[model samples]
Target: MAAPYLPMSQEEMKKLKWDQCDFIIVSGDAYVDHPSFSGAIIGRVLENEGFRIGIISQPDWRNTKDFKKLGRPYLGWLITAGNIDSMVNHYTAAKKKRSNDAYTAGGKSGRRPDRATLVYAQRCREAYKEPPIIIGGIEASLRRFAHYDYWDDKVRRSILIDAKADLLVYGMGEKTIIALAHELQERRAREEKEQSFAIDLQGLCYVTDTVATLQPQEVITLPSYEEVKESKVAYAKAFRLQEQEQNPYNGKILLQQHQDLFLVQNRPSLPLTTKELDAIYALPFARQPHPSYANQGGVPALEEVEFSLAAQRGCFGGCSFCALTFHQGRIIQSRSDESLVEEAKELVQAPSFKGYIHDVGGPTANFRQQACKKQAKAGACRHRHCLFPEPCKNLEINHDHYLQLLRKLRQIKGVKKVFIRSGLRYDYLMADKKERRRRFLEEICQHHVSGQLKVAPEHASPKVLQYMGKPSIKVYEDFKKEYEETNRKLDKKQYLVPYLMSSHPGATLHEAIEMAEKIRDWKYMPEQVQDFIPTPGSLSTCIYYTGIEPRTMEPVTVPRTPKEKALQRALLQFRKPENYELVYQALCSAERQDLIGPGSKKLISPPMSQKFKNRKLFSDKEGRGKGKGKKRRH
Candidate 1:
C-alpha cells in the first residue's frame, strides 16, 4: 500500500523511492483545502484508481529548486486549474479582489511565472527530455479558446497551446485520468522497454513531435474562437433550441477567432454520490493559511482564514455570468450533515482555528436540502435551472434540513461561530414576515450570518431583472426591511449585503437611472459591483451579445461598450465627482434629463451633491491647466 500524504515533508521525499510513484499532480492552488475545487476532487479520483499520487500545492514554479524537488514521477504530470487562481495566470495574476479572500500569489503583472502546465511541461522537458503533461480543470478547460478572463480582466486564448502541455484534458477528468493511466501502464507492461513503448502515446503529444506521427483516430474537433465569439444571433441560431437539449455542443458557444479550441465531446462530468462526497471531505486537510506564500498586495486565499467545507455540489441558479451550470451541472447534490459536522469538529480543533467556520454551503448555498422530488413523477424536469430569470413553481423550498444542519453545527464543541457567507436566495424564503420571524428569527440570529446576509438582486429595473431571471427590487427591499426589523426587535445587530450586477442585457440608461434612485434611497455604498462577464455556456451570454433570450424569444437592450459599463458601475458606486458627471451625462444623453437632480423620480443616476465637487480642486493643475472638460455621453 502507498503511504498516506500526511505530514508531507522533504524528509519523507528522502526516504521514498521515486520509482514507486505513478503520477504527480501539480496545482496553482493549495491541495485538499476545499472539496468543491478541481484540485481536491480530481486528485482523489486519480488516487482511487490505485495510482501513486503526490501533490505540489501553491507551487512556486518560478523557483527552479521547488520545481526540481517535485520531480519524482513514474508516469506523467497532471496539472490542474488550481483551488484559488485560474491556470492561465499561474505566472501572473491573482483573481480574488482583496476583499473576498480567495486569493494566492503568482508572478508580477506581465510576468506570470509561466502557466503551471507550461512551466511543468518545460520542467518535465528538462528532466525526462520528453514526458507527457496533461492539463485540465477550470483554467485549462474554460481557457480552451479565447474568452474573457476576470482575473486578468482581459481576453485570452486556448491554454493547451499556450501552456504547451502534451494532452489538454477538458471537462471532468475523473474517468479520463484513470483511462490515461491504465493505457500508460499497459504499454509499459507489454513492451518491457520504455523506449519501445513510447509509440502508443495516443491523446498525447510533445512540443518536439508532429501530429502526423499518430495513427488516424476519431479526435473531437475543437470549435474556433471566432465561431464562439460570433454575433450573439448567430451563436443562438446554432445551439439554442429545446429540441436540441441533449446536444452538449449546442450550449457551448465557440468563437471562430481563437486557436487551440478544445474538443469536449464524450467527456464525462460524472456527478458524485453523497457517500463519495463525504469520503472526499474526510480526507486529511491542512487547515492553516500559508502566510509564507502571501502576496504583498493581493487578497489572501479564504482557505487561510477558516476551514472551508463544501456541504453540497452544483448550482440551480442559471445566472448569465456563471459557468457552473455547464461545468458542475444543474442538479444539487449534498454531503450528509453528519459528514459536515465531522469536518467542522476537526476545523475548530485545527491549529489555525479562528473560532468561526467561514462558510458551509455550495453553489446558491441555501438550496442545500432543496431538490424536486417532483422530478421523479415529472421525469427529470426539463427546466434549465430552477432559479433562473425567476423561481420555478416546482422548486421545493426546504430549508428545514439546512436549518437542522446549522443547528447541529452550532453544537460542535470548539466552534465559536458558524456563518453562511454564501449567496442566500431570499426569494425562496417565502414565509410571511410574521412566519419568517417565528421560523427564521433564531436561525438567522444564532447561525448563518457574519453580521450580514448576502442576497443577489442582480438588477432593480423590471426589464433588466426580467432578462437577468431575477426577482424584483421590491421583493429584495421587502426582505431587507423585514430582516432589519426582525434583527432590531430581537436586539440582534445584523444587515443584508446585496450583490448588484451592472451592464446586463435589457439595462438601458433609463433603467440604470431608475436603479440609481433605489441606491440613493438606501444610502449605502455598495462595496461590490459585479460587471457582467459573459462566460461560455450561460444562457445570459447568448442574450448578452444577441440582445434576445434564445429560449424565451424576448428582446433585450444590451450595453454595447466598455465605457458605458464603466460609467454605469461608477453610478452604482456613486461617490466621486467624475462618476456623478458620468451619471448626469448618461441620463441627459438618454433624454431622461429630469433625472439628473433625482428625488424618487425613478432616476438611475443619483443627484450630484455640492460636496462631491468640493473634494477636488478645479484649478489648471488639477485638469492640465484648464477647468474640467464638458462631459461626453456615456
Candidate 2:
C-alpha cells in the first residue's frame, strides 16, 4: 500500500506524534501529493529524510491566520508559487485573467495572490519571525536575479529583496535543499541560535550587502539592478551572463546588486546520478491528490501526468524561447531503466490505472542522456547551443538506450501500450548517422506512438526560425519524409501533429501567412495555435520587450500590437469561423488581395457581403511591407 498523505492539519501531525512540523510548505497550488507538483516532491524528499513536514496550500494571503494554521516549522518555511509561476497560472498570454487554475482544487482561480512567492514569504514572516523563509520552484528560481517582468513591463529586483526571503533556492534544487536541511537540522537539534545561512552549494542564491567580503575568485558582478532597470543594453548584458553560468561543472558565481544587497548565485547543481535519481523516484508518493480535494472534483492537473512515467529530466535542445536551460540546466539526467520499469509496475496497480501509460519521457523525449560525454566535465559552450542552426559535430545522437527503455516498459504485464507523448527534438534524432536512428524510428512506429505523434515545427519562415533559435524548416521536412517512410513500411496510418506557433518574436504577418501556406499543403486544420508568450528569463521575451536580442544586442522586429498579434494567430487557424474576418483583414492589410479571392492560392474567400467590409483589426497600412506572398508549389 502507498504511504499516508503528509499532514496538512495539526490533528494529522498529532497522529504522527509530532509537536510541530519541521518544515511548513506554503504553496500557491492545492496540495497534491503527486511528484509532478513541486511541493509534493520537496515534502516527500524531506519526509524520506525523517523531517516533519506540513503543508498549507493556497492559503489566504490577506492575513497571517491561515499561514499560521500549520504552526511553526522547526527548520524553515518553504515558499513556492507552486508547479508554475502564479502570474502565468492566473493570466493568459494576452494578459487577460483566466477563470480557472488547473493546479487548484475545483479548478478555481484567484486562490493565490500575484507574485505568490513574495506574498507567501511575507505571510510566513508575519506568522513567525524567527525561522528562515526559503523561496523556490519555477517562479523564484527564474527570478533569483534581476529579471524582466512581462506583466509589469520593467525589470524587477531579485525575489529575495521583494519577498524579504532569507535565502532563495533556484533551479531543480533537490540536492541543495537536502544539503541545506541537514545543516539547519544540526543547529535545531542542539538548541542553538539560528545560524547564518551558508549558501555555497550549487543551484542556490542568497542576498548580501557586502560584495568585497565574498570570495572573489570567479565571481561575476553584473550591472546593478538600477542600471538594468534604466538601460536596455545593461539589461541584455545581465541576461547573457546569467544564461551562460547555468552549467554546474564549470560555471562561476554571479552577483547583481539591488539596493545595498547583492544577489549571489552559485553555480547550478550537477544533474542527479542514476542511483540518486532512482532513489528519489522510489520514494512512496501517494501518486494522487490530497484526500481533501476528493469532493471538489479532485485536482485537474493530476489527470495529465499521474499515470505517466517521467524517465528523465533536463534538455539540450536549446530553443531560445525555452526556459529549461536556466531552470533544469542543459545536462540530461535519466533514472535507471530498472527504476522506471518498477514505477510502471506500481502505476498499473493503481485503482485508476488503465491499460495505457501516458508517457515515459521528460523535457525532450528523445534526449535520454547528456548531449555528449564531455558536457559533464566541461559544461555547455558559453555562446553555443548543442542543437540550433544545426546539430553540433560533438553531439551524441543515438537513441538506442531510449529504445531499450521503451521496450522494457512495453513488456510490463498490465501495460497494453506505452506512448511517447512528450515533446521531441526531431532534428537531434535525424542527426544520428548511425543505423540506431532507423531501428529506433521503426520501434516507435510499431509500438511506442499512440496513433499520432507531436513535434514542434514552430514556424516555416527561415528568418523567424533563426531568431527563435530553431533549425531550418528543411530539417523538419526531411524528418517528415523519414517519419512517413517508417509508417509506410510498418503499414501504420499514424500522423505527426506538428505544433505550430504564431506571433513569436520576429514573426510578422508575412511569416504567419507563410506558415498557413505550409499548413494548407498538409490539408490539416489546426485545432489550436500557441501565441508566443513573453515569460520571464527567455531570450525571446528579451527581444519582445527591448526589441533587441539579448545575446547580440541587435534590434529585432517584435509583434507587440494586440490587433496584429490576434491577426497572426488567426492566420494559423484560418478555418475557424471566428477567425475568418481577421485572416481576411491580415491578407488585405498586407496588400495580398490575391490571397482573399476564390482561387487556388487564396486563404479565404472575398467578403461574403457588405457585412464583412467593417471588420478592422487590420487596415491597408497594417501589414504593408516589401515582401508579398510568393507563389510556391510544394
Candidate 3:
C-alpha cells in the first residue's frame, strides 16, 4: 500500500530500498502525515514528483546530532516551523509562556526553540556543511519581508537574510514546492562543481546585493529596511505596496533595501487548479499521524481535522487582522464534488471512523470558488476587498456547489452526519441575495452544526470593525435575528458562538466596554476569548506598531503600554472575579464609574475585601454617586 506513510526513519528507508533521500524536510511540529500539516503536504508533494524525501519533525535544535539522524541528502534541505509561527506557538498574547502546544505529541510545550526556522537552518548547516537550505511555512512566509518582531520589540530584517537560507517559498506552497524540487534537481546537476547556486523563482524571495538583473519596470524597489524602521510613514507605504503586489497575474517583482542588500519577493504562486487540488488531497496521506506517535497519545492537533476534508483554499473575506491575503492570497480554489465524495468513501472505511464528519471547509466555509468570474483571468483587485465594509457589487455569491457536496456526503452509506465547524463568513452569507444563501444557512443549522454554529462578529463598535476590515455590527445583528427566526421555524434551539477579540488596535477601553455591553445583550460569555496578538506581516500589525493604518496612513488609536493593553482585555471579561481590579481601574480611568456599581447597568460589583478600605482607590460608595461616560468622537 505504497509503504503506508512516507519514511520517517532509517529503518523505513531501508524497507523502501532507497539508498538516500533527495530532500530532508525539517519541521518544528511533530510529524503528522496529513494534508492539514504543511510538512506532510510538502513531503507528499515532493514524493509525487519522484524525489525521495523524508521528514525530520521536531528535532533537537541545540545540537546537530538529531538533524544528522537523517544523514545527508543528495539535493538539499526543505525546512519549516510547522503550520504556525514559532513565536506564536511559544508565547501567549500577554507574552506568557504557553503551557501546551496543540501541534506537539501529548500537547507538550517548549518542544522546539523560538524562531524555529532560523534555529533549524543553523542546525542543518552544522550537520552538513555544504547542504543547501530552503525555508517556508507560516513563520518564514509572513516574515519574508522586513517586519516588526513583536517578541524582540523592534523591527527585524527579512527571515531569508536572518535565517541564512537560500530561498523562501511564501504562500500555499504545493505548486511552488513541486516546481522548486524539479528546478533544484536540474540546476544542482548542471552546476555540480560550483560553490553554490542562485535560485530565481516566482512565489519565492531571497536577498540580493543589487537589482541590476531585472527587466525595466518589472522590479519594484520598496523603502529600504533602515528607512521603514525609522519612519512609520515609510513603513506604511512599503506595507501597502506589498499588499498590492500579492496577485499572481498582475503582481510585480517586489524589492526593498536592507542595508546594502536588497530583499526581493517575486509574485505569488498561481493557485492550484481544481485538478491540481484534487490530486493533492487525493495523495495517500495515511490520513492520520505516523504510527510511531501512537504511544505518545498520537497527535492532538489531528483530533479535530483527522477526518475533516479541506474543501477549498484561500479567502476573499479580507479581514485586515488575517494574514490569509499574504499567505494564501484572496483567490478561492476548491476540489470537485466527485473527488471530495470519493474521500468520504475512504473516510467511512477507516476502523476508527465515527459516523460524524467533523468539517468540510477551508479559510471560509461558504467560499467555494472565486469571488467573481473575472478574478480568475485577471486577479483580485489590489486596492479593493471582496467582503469588507461591504460586499463588492461584482461579487458572485453562490453556495450551491458547497451544498451539493454536503448533500452527497450525507448520502454516503456509513456517514450519519457531516458538520461545518470551520468558520463561516457572516457577511458573505448575508451578502447573497439569492434563496440558496438562506437554504445554505438552513442546511448548516439543520444538519451541519454540532449544537452551535460559530461566527466572528469581532466587535460591536463600527470604528473598531473598520480598522479590522470587518463589516459593521448591524450586519451581525440582522444575521442573528434571521438565524433565530430560522430556528424558530424549525423548532430547534441551535445556538451561535460569536468569536470575540480584545485589545485590537483602534479598540480602547471605550470600545471594549461597548462590546461587553453587546455581549451582555446577547447574554453570552464567550468560552473562547481571542486576545489580539500581532503576528508578523499582517495589516493589523502595521497599525499596532506604527500607530498608522497601512492603507490609509491615518493616525490610529493603538494601546501599546502593558497596563492599557491589560485593562482593555480585562474589560471584555468584566464579570471574571480576577479581572475585577483591572476592570475597576479601567472604568475609573475612563471615568465611567456607572459600569462598576451593583446596579442592573453595572458590569461588575465592587470587591468585598477590607483592603478596599485600606486603599483609597477602592471605595465603599462604588458609583453610588452616578457619573456619565465622557463623550468621545469616532
* C-alpha TM-scores of all predictions: 0.76, 0.95, 0.94
Clashes of 3: 0
Segments of candidate 2 deviating more than 4 angstroms: 1-3, 190-195, 609-615, 618-634
Model 1 agreement with the true structure over 64-167: per-residue lDDT tens digits: 55545555567777777464333333322123223222444432332224345566556655655444677777656545544444444344455666676666
lDDT of 2 by residue, 1-634 (tens): 2238888888887888889888999999898887888999988898888888899999989999898887888899999999898888888888899999999888988899999999899889989999989999999998888888888978888888899998888887889999989889887777888557667878788887787776778888899999989988888888888888888888889999887778899999888998998998888888888888889988889888988989899888888888878898888888999999999999889888888999989998888888887887787888888998888888887888898898899888999999989998889888986487788889999998888999998899998998889999888999998999999999999998989888998888898998988887777788888888888878888788778888878888999877778889989988777677778778877877777777666787777667556645444465433332322221
- Candidate 2 residue 613 Cα shift, in angstroms, is 4.6
| Model 2 error, position 605 (Å) | 1.8
Please provide, for model 3 over 365-483, each residue's C-alpha lDDT reduced to its tens digit, 9 standing for 90 to 100. Answer: 88998999889998899888888778999999887888888999999999999999888988888888758767977887888888788999988898899999999998898999888
Q: How far does residue 24 in candidate 1 sit from its true spot (Å)?
A: 1.8
Candidate RMSDs in Å, in order, are: 6.6, 3.8, 4.6
True-structure lDDT of candidate 3: 0.85
